[model samples]
Target: MSTFGDIFGAMRQVILTQARLDQLDVRMTRMAGDIDGLADGISLLRDRISRLEGIIEGAAMAASRQQRRIEE
Candidate 1:
């Protein structure tokens, strides 16, 4: 029932839609990889911050003890 022009137009639309979907798929995959990398970086930073916090706490405790010894 469709005319030739109509059929051709419909096929063209489908092709364009498929191309767009493929491009989007590639972009989404790259974005997912980037997000994973960012997550790893954040985790590393958190661990380093935790270690630094421990060092700071230990130093503060030691200074307090030294001050107490001097006062005594």
Candidate 2:
């Protein structure tokens, strides 16, 4: 036979567990948003890097042409 005190204690434990779970859910949601922001930042960096690579390649080609003309 379960005593009333035991039943109330169990109920209290259940409530506390649920509260903790809710807190975790909120934290997870915030973390997901942060991750999304990071992903956007990474994408922007990649685009800038690609543009810089193109500029560097153009400069290299121009230098090569100038060198060939000088050697002629």
lDDT per residue (tens digit) for residues 1-72 in model 1: 469889999999999999999999999999999999999999999999999999999999999999999999
What's model 1's overall lDDT? 0.99
Instruction: Name the regions of candidate 2 deviating beyond 4 angstroms.
Output: none
Per-residue CA lDDT of candidate 2, range 1-72, in tens?
469889999999999999999999999999999999999999999999999999999999999999999999
**lDDT, candidates in the order shown:** 0.99, 0.99
User: Residue 50 in model 1: shift from native, Å?
Assistant: 0.6
Error of 2 at 8 (Å): 1.6
For candidate 1, the 10 contiguous residues with the lowest summed lDDT are 1-10
